[model samples]
Target: MSVDNISRADELVPSRYAVPVGDIEVLVISDGVLPITASTLATTTPPAELAGWLDDQFLPRDVVDWPLNVVVVRTEGRTILVDAGLGVEFPDFPRAGQTVARLEAAGIDPGAVTDVVLTHLHMDHIGGLLTEGLKARLRPDLQVHVASREAEFWEKPDFSHTVMPQPIPDVLRRTATQFLNDYRGQMRTFEAECEVAPGVLVSRTGGHTPGHSIVRLESCGERLTFAGDAVFAPGFDNPQWQNGFEHDPEEAARVRVNLLREVAATGEALVATHLPFPSVCHVATAGDVFRCVPAVWDY
Candidate 1:
């Protein structure tokens, strides 16, 4: 279940984009790709409406490929891994279990991971916590941080009522049992807007998933926010479009609009877990819609 071992430094990193913010190096890592069907998008936004929005953007009428991104914050005291990628469970998924290998290839020993921040308990964001044996993999000593709301929601037997793609609710229920058994004392919860690390703060960005949070990093004069699933693709600003997997489409759309305005006004570099590969980009407002100008960085 492991990828071929290669030199950590010499191995080609997958579309990694890094920017030095004071003493911290924010490296955006791509786990792989997620393919969503038209029906999937319709679950949140009507298919016809979504197609119309896509047409306006000049995008294709086929499937949408959302690349999985994990942000790595390297600071002097700790190596903070923000959200593990979708784990090895989905054999059919192209990038289901590559997060660990990619991090290792980038010179990051799994044992050195001090914290695994869970934006939410969605399978794609947290399935990487366990090994093939279902044992915790990130340093045995590392702590798993999650929002208090995220823990409570996943623990509920009726958690499915809040998630889309009905199959996902079942996945969360099963994963919850495994996580509790393996991550016992290692799991901790945080209140809203708490600073977990130097230059890193967790902010509530619900609507995508209850307890879903985004991490903000600021150092010197540079600022970068890992927006998690708050804004699904740049298409979010299309007040006419709704995200494909949002828990509350209306609320998610509202939050995204506000966030887009905030980040656009702040002029900070931002990254998302499901944006295209090397997803670091600067946000800008265009008329009523928002546009993403990918940050130019050498691989």
Candidate 2:
């Protein structure tokens, strides 16, 4: 079971990576990559500063390949999935929406998933809950947990925004409505924070979205945090930088800083959805700044 053949630099690396947390076993699966221009991150930062930072990190200044790492936790006889990736396909993001394929690659049967915990209702996070034709895709019996506010926000017709074009939001709302209606009995919502499974808790970390949250897993004294787009890697190290895609840049920045500090202090392993593939890492303080130290892959 050695993963010695897998390399991060490979264009098509293995879709699943194993993470050990005491007695619990966690699987990090790749949904796919989303290509975004580096300039779009921290839009307010000066171009010179941003370029210098990217240079220091040895990252391409023009564009970055943002990977989608969806976590699967198996504990207490339960199979729980965190954040469904983009459904079947996304025309705007050609490389995205490979969650289903990746899950199968990891030998996980979709029917075995007892719960789907959505970190937020963003298109990328919730899109995988339905088929391209806008039909529920997960097992009808599995419970789907989402933030109460997030579900409400998408149901309204006037939840307009400048982040995405008019058509995008419209489609999102439509699909959201369909999902809610199709799985009325299985859909559930929570407020603030609550334990969704035996050792999994969802805590609201609003800023990215009204009801956005990060999932916390604890078992046998080991802990892991599934940070759903709370922040990106390098830009987020400087908490002051604001992402252009954030619904509330100021609040998002505040939450990101707090989360980094908390993880650093508690020694919690973090899995950021938008970081590079196999996004499991630990946060640490480097002088006055925060840095991401990637976790070594375990077979």
Candidate 3:
């Protein structure tokens, strides 16, 4: 049968996708997309090999669009937000910083969010916690939780020795300080692993940052994992590939490989920040590598 013509919206709008884990609901809210060069992804992989992989996948070898996903978990009485997106003031990427608007569209009130769990302290992950001026906290009354090691590192950053460029460390330090000061009393940190909410647990994965972590949601008998930036797109298939943004490439690869195995074995759903839109998927072992099977949308 021939398909009928359909009208498309003129203006772009933020997208949101929801999934249920037993009694709890998890919403994948889009902050926006960031266009990054393919070379920036697999930093250590040879250019020829990287190009061949992209070609095989039918993807562009030049620039790849990475999505910024902010997750919101709704339970019986609390609204928990994971990894705030880049806020309005990020000069580098004008298309980003739409987390609040997207969250609102998903029926979540920013003010009603009782807790904000940060998987790490990268600018893209923590920028939405404050207002444009960076003078005040956006979710004022909420308890903001980050990894203890992450907090310590940012508290006194040594720019001379890091994976990022010279200016990034300074910028990150300034923003992180502002966020910590603004929410002084409400900020909390965890060491290895701890439960932020009833069934919401944060576990330190490290590598991407000294304090990088992943959030696991358990409700009834179902489970969902917010993998953060630990395992990006093509990296999932090649878990040992070095990522340009990782603080320690070797450690990052180890963490990713271990996590992928666990996810594959247990059959838990994973939501990665840089994966394709509506980034919920399952992992399957493919010989020594792994593959991501995007979850089917349910009506």
Clashing pairs in 1: none
Q: Write the per-residue lDDT of candidate 3 for residues 1-299, one digit (tens) a residue.
A: 00012111233653788899988889898888877777767887899999998898787999877789989998868888899987766657766777766665655667788888999888888888764533242456678888889888778865432455446667788888877777668878889998877888999999888899999999888999999989998777778877767877888889899989999999999999998878889999999999999999876
TM-scores of the candidates in the order shown: 0.88, 0.87, 0.90
Cα deviation of 116 in candidate 1 (Å)? 1.2
Candidate 2 C-alpha lDDT tens digits along 8-71: 3334667778887877789988888877778767688999999998898788999877788888
Number of the candidate with higher lDDT, 1 or 2:
2
Task: Give me the runs in candidate 3 sitting further than 4 Å from their true place.
Answer: 1-14, 133-140, 158-167
lDDT of 3: 0.80
The candidate with the higher lDDT, 2 or 3, is 3
- Write model 1 residue lDDT over 1-299, tens digit each, in one string: 54433223454545456777777888777777766564554455566877886687676667666678887888868889898888777765764556776777677777788887888777788777764633434567787888887787666644332435556566767876677677768887886766778888888777777788999888898888888888666454564455556666677777778888888999997788877777778888898989898887664
Better of 1 and 3 by lDDT: 3
Model 1 alpha-carbon miss at residue 229, Å? 0.5
- TM-score top scorer: 3
